[model samples]
Target: MKIISFGVNNFRGITGGLENNTIEFNNSNTIFLLGQNNVGKSSFLKAYEFFYKNTSAAVEDIYRMNPENVIEFELVLQLDEFDFQKDSIANKKEGLKKWLNPDNLLKIKRVLKPKIGAKISFEKTENYTWDYEQNGWVAKNYGGIGLDTVFQAALPTPIFIKAMPTEAEGEAIINEILKQKANANLEDKDRLELKEAQAKIQELQDKLYNPESIQSYKEEVNKYFQSLFPNTKIELSEKDKTKWTENSIGKSFAIHFEQNNNGEKDETIPTSHERIGHGAVRSAIFSLLLMKDVAEEFERVDNRKDYIVLFEEPELFLHPKLMKQLRTLIYKVSETDTPYQVLCASHSPQMIDITKEKSSLVRMTKHNEGTRLFQINDEFLKDSKEIKTKEELKQEMNEILRFNPFICESFYADEVVLIEGPTEEIILRGYFNEVQIDKDIFIVNCGTVNNIPFFQKIFSRFNIKYHVICDSDAAEVKELDNYGLIPFETGIQKSIYQQLKSDYEKVDYSVGLFHVNVPTFEPSHQQESIKDNLKYSNNYLASDGKPYNENLYWKDVLKPNLNSEEINTVPIVKFLKNIVDHN
Candidate 1:
């Protein structure tokens, strides 16, 4: 049971409009939710909880309180027969098969129906729909299964890690693990006896404490008190009568862990490390969730597919090393053979596992109208997958990150500008600091002239506002065509510009030439043309009456140009200013 996509309205902060509205999965299992503060990254996950996991939440609990408000949501699921086997009702398989169309997909919706505004006393209904290749969407007979059963069949057990985590969230999991480990200490016969006694004890415990079981008892007590009192009624609850804590399985079992006293002598301790920090507790829950068996357990129970987890800021309180480790583990778990998927809300770039063939990061933001979610993989980088293999793209991105981690800013920036090489990047970065006030724009060094086109292809594919600034080196391009037309670097630029023009009309570009006869960043003297890559240039005489080298020329030539009030007067920097300003 996996939720492919969902739509919610008038629930919590998601008011449902052109801004905050439907979320389409478009077929991704591991998803990363990215956003700024209060942009609905957390709210979206909470909405999923109420819509899918909180089966007992009433209309009053879910309906957003506002003028003329009503709550409704729909989920589209990619169904599988393997999960349908969990429905032990002999006829459940029949119903599952009947609902599963040729595409193996099912659509369901929850609505409090009554057109009247502010109406809470309306009929709640869950509708199921299927589609045919020719006839389009058709209603299905999910009537046989209750709304609760439909939910079970559609999605997995949702494990959510709240934005504000506490030790309480992980205590139960720890207790269960300790209890299971403790069973190893018992003899076979003793274990069996304990199991039987536990079952009997739980049975009695349920009878005394279960809300349904004690419902009549509470009503009778209220009636008895009401007879003695005129306008008062009794409210009763059932809890442990034992004043002292009972010696239950949990109390009897405990795990003694060795404590490293701040890297000093080790000591065996029985207490928890919860008081130490929030990071430890958050890591504990996350590590347990990544356990192999725990992941496998998320698979369909009794053959019915179901299980999922929502993690908000899983990287909180951890160092970069741990964050990377957790990120890798999450990638492994989400890719397992089980439908157990991991979707996390994260602000840390380290939480992103972009090495996967498929990109899973989804960017979210808030607007005046509502919140918006942009699926980066399906919307922008989808075409790149077809042109380049996953390995190929991963290698390129890894290499990009190796030298300049700042290049990764393109993943989050609203607009991206690609520069040809380090010289251009440095020059522009310095000038940008002096002029560009907008922090949302990014500038990346493309490493080489050839890399500009490659980077532009990706940005264009992603629908990002992209522009390029490259060195023309046109003055030195002496290669001649059959018509005696000299076109070398200029030819390459024309081809790239044409492609950019075709990809986006009115192409935005800025090309700069070295001092008329100069070529690359390393401009040597005219007599030493072959030494253009070297630091020293004989053309400009230094104060010591020596020809200037790359080092001397930078201080003598570059620094002054950069520090000038008219920094934008420089050809390349000026072009960059135009592209960035327009954007």
Candidate 2:
């Protein structure tokens, strides 16, 4: 069984009911929850935890601490034939099978209306299940089982990895990994060693908890206690327990790192787990969560349990290279035979992988009505037959995004500035630096003027406000080396900015288009002599022997002219300032 969608109301900053605040899961195994802070990304994950645990809530859990408010959680679960066949409870299995919708989905809701002036608890909470015939949640006659019972007994549990995990939590995760390793199948030599170790532990337990030793320890405790109260008698009872459970034994285990200099005995040293850096500790915890061996064990079982991993700020303490590695590992684990879904509330663009068909990006925003969600649709060019096929457009997007992580940051921005090349990106960054305009604006270098329209299609599909800034030119189109032209969009190239505005005029949405009246950007508002120098400067290449350093134009040609008061009034600069002011 897997979660199809979750809804929350009056829980933390989420004040809207399920009707207004439902988050539907995507088809991909990994889903990225993108948002700025305080938009309820963490709160949404906690609501999933609450649905599974059904723990007590605090007064503050109510939205805005209103005493009259009630917290509600709703979940729609998707189940298959395998789920029904593996059920151990015959009664519940039959009832659930009968209650299942035609599409094999079940919607269950938990409502907690806190009692006035009493402890907040789930004892009096209302539970309901969606009825297909009625088309609403039905509280009574649920095939002899309540929604809470089915939800708890049938649904899969989630594993939540917090942003800042405590040391004890880290140890607990490591112990879980070790415990799985111990229980997994082993070779003859390892089996022999494990048995021998267990036998020795048993011997120690027998000596420590025997009747004679218990009597002696009891006398020692009572001797000290009796001195404080002369007339009182202390009694000690022995249950004859001598064996330690697997959890108890695991608690005694500790993780250590070893350092040595190529087989030199003098340099050998052991570093305790506590002494390790936080980055190393977090890496170790998440690395163990891959559970390759445990996944194999799961494959062998007929009734495998499913899990959804909730990770908050997975790039908390890791460097860029490590963040890439961690992101790769997450996708690797999800693709395995083990049933797992990974969702992360992340701020790093490095953690995003929208190239995958199943991967999805959802943005959360706060408003007068509370937190609302927006998702990027997979089919952006489905109806765009005039330009290119959907598959071709998608392939182009994936190829460019694979090599450019900076462009991926546009998914998190409140407003975007789409430029033609790195020259524009550098100039905009410099402009924003000179005049500090506070806004969550992301400038994406589309690599070429023609491709700006494709990216505009993306922002339009996701309802993200964006501005397009490209040159106004009429030149003979040339075939590029790195990229191919969109079919039917070639032949003779006119002003691409004007064509973009014409296309957006037909749509219900509006796009901000900023372009200079001059033929190209290099000569915009420049004198004839400076324009000649700008053209000549493009001939010189940097030390790396690639295309001329894009920054060279910014520092040598653009910077000096930008200082002039007249240059600040250029169309591109003024348009950028407007974006920062309005957004």
Candidate 3:
């Protein structure tokens, strides 16, 4: 079974109405949540665990408080043929009902605090209802199996093995097993059983003491140790026969060390497992648990649809190189035929790079208003044009847009008006309304003024005509000039001011002019407008009552320049109309 979508409300930092946060899994068999630290990346993972397993472990603290702070998580699971076959055989049903039964589908949910318990609830697609007053889902099947049984059947069982076992523990277990298997010239049946038991004990001891033998069992373990402690070396030796000390019989293990520079031998070195660092210990434990889980799955003939794995900072206590390797490991595990779905939260950039495309990344950020979840969308990549290869493009687009969530693709517009910020974008949009211009012209704020060059490049590359309005700052002017764009400097109201600077002489034809300091004239004040057409706003005056100004001055400007029919109406409208006419 595969989860298609999930919804949550009043869950921890998440409150208000249903966020409708969903994840869709492809046949590619992977899903990743990519975001920076503390962005509810971990919270989403916990939510998945809480919903599907009904396990209070992930949400127990939140549940202890107000019962009304209830979190509702719903998953749409796609039932495969194996699930249908198993359910049909178990329930002994026939026809469409047998094939389409809710019980056969994996639908898991949990309500925190309100009802702190974990169990399978029969709320499959076929039986779903929009009625909110149901209080709870009608349980067609209740408490079928514990999460452990299902988890063990699906995910790798988590085994956290530290370094090799201590000599005392190894010896004690070995002696006990040896004593149990010991007998004098036993019969064939007893001898065979004893040998089998002896072999099992030896294997266990060998894993603890013999590095080479353990490598035979798990190659990853050896590789991990080598990468972690490059200077130290380990080997297993047989028990010394002549000097048979009582303390050393079952614990007959020795570690030999050689100095990095010299050939000097250290025969009495400490255990390699003990000498390894804490990070190495953690990695070893994680690897053992993962291996055990994989092995158990092979032992049972469970269908792939029933598996789910949850990881929290899998990169913790790991080196950058190892963290990268861990990512590859995650991908490898996900690619298996078993229905292995992995949800992990990580702060490392390496982790983000691993599954950049095949995941749902929610960026949680704080603003003056409050906390908000900004789902990373395709708009983030609107300024980027570096993607070349198909795979790179797919991953880049997927990473940013969440697969075209915007829905509406084509916007009918001839000329594009690009602004610097959201506020300006909104104000201009409203201004265009006052002017009664057709709304079809695309007016977009490329997020920041710095991105003007990028936006221009993209539009030019696509053969789209566009106009950009930006601040008169040196950097903004330089950027626009670099892109061969005309700058629309805000605020001058006299033709003399335009001719005062030679910079405007270069691009006078293409450039548009306006001033931040200039005052506007009403139709009734035509005589007054002629007398003081160059007057400035009080807000633009310095402490000396003179107009505060910038370096570059406009060469040609007029009163209410932007609205005048000869200047604003003809030039601006013609520039816009030309795009469609020429195209």
**Cα lDDT tens digits for candidate 2, 87-143:** 344446656654578877877777888765565443376778777777877765353
Q: Each candidate: what lDDT?
A: 0.53, 0.61, 0.40
Cα RMSD for predicted model 1: 12.5
- TM-score of model 2 vs. true structure: 0.73
TM-score of each: 0.69, 0.73, 0.44
User: Which is the leading candidate under lDDT?
Assistant: 2
Q: By descending lDDT, how would the candidates be arranged?
A: 2, 1, 3
Residue-wise C-alpha lDDT for candidate 3, range 1-583, written one tens digit per residue: 5554555555555444344344444333444544445445556655664544445433343422444455555554455554434432334334323223353444444443353337322222122212123434443333121232422233222111212334443333323222222211123464354356654444333333355433342444334444444544333344444223322323443333232324345555554546655554444443332332232333223332244455666777778777767766565555545435565555555654322334433334322332344332223233244454546656644443342222111112335665555434443544465455443456656555544554454433222345554444432222233323433353311211222222234431222222211112112122233334332223333333211121000112332344654433322233333432432
Model 1 worst lDDT window (10 residues)? 508-517
For model 1, residues 472-572, the per-residue Cα lDDT tens digits are: 56634555444323333454465455445555443432222112123544442222423233223445444453222433554555455664555443445
Residue pair clashes in candidate 1: 1-305, 83-304, 83-305, 156-306, 156-307, 157-307, 535-550, 536-549
Residue 544 lDDT in candidate 1:
52
Candidate 3 residue 426 C-alpha distance from true site, Å? 30
- How does candidate 3 score on lDDT? 0.40
